[model samples]
Target chain A: MDRGRLALSLIALAAALALPFVAGPFWTGLATQMYIFGLLALSVDLLLGHAGLFSLTHASFFAVSAYTVAILQVRYAVPTTLAAPAGILAGTLLAAVFGISVRTRGVYFILITIALGYVVWGVAHRWSSFTGGDNGVTNVPFPAIGGVGITSHTQYYYLVLAVILLCALGYRVLIRSPFGLGLRGIKASETRMQSLGYRTSAHLYAAFVLSGALASLAGVLYVYYNRFVNPVASSFPISVEAALMAIVGGSGTIIGPFLGAGVVLGLRNWVSSFFEMHHAIMGAVFIATVLWAPDGLVGIAARLRARFSRPKEPGP
Target chain B: MTQLAIEVGALAKVFGGLAAVDGVSLSVPAGERRVLIGPNGAGKTTLFHCITGTLKPTRGSVRLFGRDVTRDPEHRRTALGMGRTFQITNVFPDLTLLENMTLAIVGTDRRKWVMHRAVAAFADVRRQALEGLEAVGLAGRAAQPVKLVSYGERRQLELALALNTRPKVLFLDEPCAGLSPSERQRISKMIAGLPRDITLVMIEHDMDVALGLADRVTVLHQGRVILEGTPDEVRANAEVREVYFGHG
Candidate 1:
């Protein structure tokens, strides 16, 4: 990390840490949502931005994890110590199975993931006896360990902020790693990568599962924060929105997804207050982003910075 | 007394009722430099693909170091000491040359799976990457992305990517496919200077580079080997003139 980026991250951390005490409850809650959804988007980008696999089934892992935590905790009275890990493990296991989808590429990969996601959604929506149908599993409390537990939403927000911060740091390391570069190489040219002796399919499969695990982590965070799990959590729209968040912010950067989540959530919150056609507006925004700023908002910001900082000297 | 490095037995590849490579068999001894030359659409590239496992032969088998690898996938072929450069300059355009070399250096090894450590932290990888770039005369431009470099430089990077994999048998599909006279000489010289311990099979349209570099030449016409011999025999043959040299 450069000095400027490090300083910016420190400032963002400080602001996030101080948000609950400094800002209103609504803003803090919104920030928490942003972090959670941003993490989800980051997971999706692991394949989308790096491996060039556009998966439409990440929400399956997210909802599977959330539902696992909800059922294990609410119905079976499982402890947080057991339920949280089980939730993550269950979601990660689903991701491992779905990792087989990496055998396909481009449109086929996208279609397979879509079908896989729908299977999970169908189960969550139609399996009423166990899933509770549309009402979902409720009366879920905040996550706690032994006697030390979250008593307020503010505390949960801080916990989520902390976890996401750690995740971002880890994600940064992963992207800068050799394995990460390998993913980007595979994205650029799979044949070339194979010629260079990389087992491209295996590389992509690993990335898919790791991405799923991250999405599962996001799901666990979501269940604890929302206090419930429903079929909506597993729906197609959430998956699309998570991907859109990454694209809208910037697909390749770590902070981009979070910033994108904030933008999407903030816009939805503000726009729906007055306009009934907010979704149409969202569509327009996405189209504009794709057309005018294909690299997303971060790329725009970088370009602007480069333009402004260019030397004023006359000679080249 | 040389061991056979690559042995192909009656290989055939068919596409939509047309045979691209039909009933071709060739054996290359270890440490020999062999070149394949033919007119356009003579199945030279198709033959290269079949040998490298990029395109599976419809019939027959391929052996590497006397081991049958006919069923091996392209990547497994790579791991078993086979490496190739494409006719087109194929490389990671968005990555810096160092990164490109880094992938090649660690690709055949387990280091490509180290997800926790930053690539910058791998001092050996970085050093070897720089050295690999240096071998291609690209160390000065190590930090530049592949797309920013000239086509000739990308071609060099292509050869560099293949070479860094430490293959026992290396295949070059027109490594100097598009280049100026000077750039072509430079690349051909680079190929000629490679350690003779590694087996080399190359496809070249430039007969001067092909005949000059080959220990022996194989000429293909319409997917069958028409002739195989020393450069002098291939040059003076009346049949080669009609089909390949265009005049006796």
Candidate 2:
């Protein structure tokens, strides 16, 4: 961390802290969504960027956790304390089962996760008796403890900010850890990792489960913020969008996913205001990203910085 | 009586209808430098894979230090004191040499599972990685990524990765493959200098390095062991000259 970067980071942090006051409620709300979804993208990157696994079933965990929190809180009148943890546990358990997808690789891996995700979406969409189907479980209240409760969306935004910030800090330590490096090694070459004494499958399974747990946490936050849970939360596009967010922002870095979330969500809001084929615009953006900036906006920024920083040689 | 370091009993690996390793069996005693030399397509690497648990044999079992490990996976074999280098260089190209060595150092132990602490914080692991790199003459290039190093350096990193795991039975699959003559001598000297307590199983195409380092030689042709004897005997055998030298 250089002085320049540190100063820049502090400025960014200050801006984020002062955003709700400076900007109107709309921008605050959108920023909040960006942070929440950014966390989901970060979770996906744990496997995608590090372990070299491309899982499309992450939304299953996200929705399962969200639905659990919604139903428990809204229907059974469970407190946020129990419901949130329970939601995370439920999502993590599903991830553990889904982690078996690590047994396959390449196209087979992608296919299995897609199929698994569809099963969850199908249950949420078709199982009307318990799941409440398309309408889903609604009127979920804001999280409230014994004495303290978040009464408004603005306060909830701050809460989301605080939680994601802590998560980001923790994630920084984690990615720099030996286990994290092991994941990178596996990504570079799994066969070599195995010969080097790593059970590549087991490392991947653990990463999958951990990634799912993070997504589950995001889901709990989403449920509280949106005040509802729907089948759309578990849909395939959400999973795809999450992966895209990580890729667009930078798959391997912390700020990259959040930055990518801002790009995607902000682009949608801005473009859909007047554009009829807003999704088409998104498709084009993704295409451009893959063709020119495969490492995401973060990588592009790095290239620019390097180019500018290098001193020019004297004339021949 | 010499203790058996590795015992492959009737090992076979078949790819569809083709038996790449067709019922090959070997017994290398502890503290012996056993080299396997054979022509291309003789299933030398396949046999090495089976013995190192890279590929499972369709029949027979592999044992390490008299323990049944045929069912064990590659990582488990490494944990049970078996380590190997690939015939083709297989170091992690994206990782720094230090990180590569760090992985090999912590691989067999519980430290590899520690997720909370950054790798840089482990001073002892870093020290050991540097020392291990020094052993392979790679200490100066510790911070460099494998991709930046020359192919010869990558080969040395390959051997370093295996040695850091602290294996009792070491397998080097053409460890000197694709190197200059001087580089070949450097690697062969490294192999020959290894402690005799560690069982050495190597596959080499260079007859000079192979015979010079080997206490005994095993010759394979058409996926079967054709000769297993002392280096002098293997060099003298007319059948070997006919097959290995292609004089027949």
Candidate 3:
């Protein structure tokens, strides 16, 4: 990272560390949700921004993992150590199956993922015997490992903040890796990549699976934070919202998704309090974003910086 | 006896009712520079595509160094020492020229699967990518995005990308198709300077560039080889003149 970016990151870290103490429980709670969903959006961007695959079934992985943890911990009395990995494993396995959708490109890939997502949603919504119907697996306790445990929301916020920071750092490394470069090349021209000796389908499938695994991680953080795994967690809007967050923040950058999640969740929370149809306002904002700021907030920031810092030149 | 680097027997490709390549048979000896010349719709590209495993032929076999690879996928063929440049310039526009070259360098190896370390950590790949770019006269433009470079430079990078794949048999599809005379000379000089140990199969519209680099030339008319001979023999053939250059 450049010195400026490093400084910015340190300041952001300090602010995040102090948020719960200064802002109270509500803001801490909201900030916690932002980090979780931001991780989810970061996963979606792995394919969307890097590999150029638009997947609509991330919610499937997210919710499946959440439900797995909720069921294992609540009903079976499983410890956090086993249940968390189990949730990630279940979600990742589903992603492997859904990874077959990579065979089709463009609209077909989108359609297949949507259909697959609906299958998961239908099971979560209608499977009352095991999934607890619409009420879902509830009264889930905060994640506790052996004697050390999270006692309150403020403490949990710090844990989440730590996890997200680690994830962002790891994500930074992954994107700059050789494997990551191959994904970007595939995005530019699959034919060229194939001729360059890459199995484009295999590359895309691997990316899809990894992306699903990340979404699954976010889902684990979420159920513990929200204290339940409902059908809404697996709904289509959740997947769409995750993608929208990535786009609205800056699809390719690490911090962009987190910033986007803050904008989206903050707006929804503030708008819904006064207006009955806040969804319409959200819709308008998204349309405006697409029309005028297609590159999202980060792109806008870059443009503004370039404009302001451009050197003056003499003209005839 | 000279070994055959590439052998194709009765190759045919049919798209709907039209046969793009029909009953084409060819054999190129190892380390020989061969050029295919034909009119616009003479199935030269289709033939190249079938041989390189880009498009599966409807019928016939393709053998590389005595091994049949008719059913192998494109990347598999690339692994088996086949590399090709597209007729059109195809490259990673968003990535820097060095990044594009790096992808080509690690593409045929296990390093492409290495995700833990950054690409810059591979000092050897960086050096080789720079060397590859330098060979193509694009070393100075390594940090520039391919989109920002000149079209002629992209053509050069396209060839560089193919060379970095370590192909024993290099297929060049109109390597100088859209270059100015000087740019064409530069690309052709690069092709001519390539080590003769690597087999070259090229499609060219410019007869001067084609005949100058080709050890032998094959003329195709209506999806079949009309004549195969030395550059001088092809130039002297009346049949090639009638079909390739239109009527007298």
Candidate 4:
């Protein structure tokens, strides 16, 4: 709430609002993808950064939502409006069931979540009747809100931006609340928290359900914007991408994941044009970032600004 | 008659073939200052863990304030007014001393899950946390992170964490385990000044400190009580002198 933070937030908001006007159509399309990815990254941050859970199965939730929208629209002839909520509800229920069981053990917890992600992926691939299987569901309808259809690319871009901003605000409020502090305490030391009469498992289960719902929202947006749903959307590599984005931006901080998503997603779109080994380059960059800025880019930037702005003491 | 703060009846804990806590039974009346002393590996810590519900006993029951809490979890025991300090100091290193104590007090209040309420707005919680720190003579270092404080101060912070919960029964595990003589003396005075209404049970290896503080003493050997009586009676017992105190 300081002047500096307020100013930074306002500036970022202005940039996001102005992006469509300044960028070409192709770049505008890519930025929209980044915003969707940013929402997914923020959800992952809630678990990994705040709750001290390391997960590699969030893509299952994402895929669940995307597939629900695709299948409902294509097979069951369900309207887009109803499908969105239904998909989110499905993802939340699935996540809660998995979260309750997996949140018990330590390292094995993470492994089980990964295995669950693979299980979902296998189902999506093998069940061709409903999912369209390997080829995916294509020509999904555009979202229409209150009879206002969003068919143009610019309209879709603004829709993604609006959802991202709303979710970001929600994340901000949640993290500043008492529940957020409990999650931080859970992260710092579970044994100490338990001794203070906190049932940590219940808190973790709720967080998982909430995070899954949010990830599913992103998945719904992705299906709307692209008019397609693919098996790769729920693949392990995409889950890894979400984790890396959360880390690169800064985990617990609200804006960190969004900033991380913008940078990495932007870089991928820019470099894929000419490079054949973009994945290798991204891997190297990830290694370097981990070594040099373990706290992420925001932490590095803060340290640099502090060094120059603060008064220095003379050597004795 | 005063209520029994803790009642352990025929408690036994077995890991594989070894009996960690073998058939231990004792009772401490409300407001009594009791100490258990023995050599290393005498199952003192194991008994503490069982009473606190950290480790489930294979047999017998533990009752706190006439409620059977034998199968309860550690958190449930904590909620029922049983405060404990670990043998190893456990304070939040990254958080300030005030924040560490505040967490305990807030957690104990059962309002920690109120997501929208700001912690700073809770004036009563802040006041109680500060009072707990002051009780341990840590008021001056309240703003400093616990990691920045000395080892002795960190130990005091651990005690402060327990006190903020306002428990009816306090279990101090080696309250002076690694303290310097001066630090040990200060902690001794602190413990001696606690409200008489709070039942105190502690495990101590320092015989001199235990004798000075405890109204009654129990000596354990290899997982069983060898002697139990008033401090004077325990000191006079022949078997305790030969087997534990190394004198006859």
TM-score per candidate, chains pooled = 0.99, 0.98, 0.99, 0.94
TM-score of chain A of each: 0.98, 0.99, 0.99, 0.96
Which tens-of-lDDT digit does each residue in A24-103 have in candidate 4? Answer: 89888888888888889888989988888878888989889988888887778788778888888887878887786545
Candidate 3 lDDT, tens digit per residue, A150-236? 999998998999888888888888999999999999989999999999999999999999999999999999999999998999999
Alpha carbon lDDT at A225, candidate 3: 96
Q: For candidate 3, lDDT tens digit of each residue in B205-243?
A: 999999999999999988999999999999999999999
DockQ per candidate: 0.90, 0.85, 0.92, 0.62
- Off by more than 4 A, model 3: none
Interface RMSD of each: 0.7, 0.8, 0.5, 1.5
**RMSD in Å for model 2:** 1.1
By TM-score: ranked, best first:
3, 1, 2, 4
Candidate 4 CAPRI level: medium
Per-residue error (Å), model 2, residue B161? 0.1
Stretches of candidate 4 off by over 4 Å are: none
* lDDT accuracy of residue B107 in candidate 3: 97
- Tens digits of per-residue lDDT for model 4, B89-141: 87777778877877888776657777666667778877988888888999999
Where does model 1 exceed 4 Å of error?
A313-316
User: Per-residue lDDT tens digits of candidate 2, residues B58-162?
Assistant: 998999999999999999999999999998998888889999999999998988898999899999999999999999899999999999999999999999999
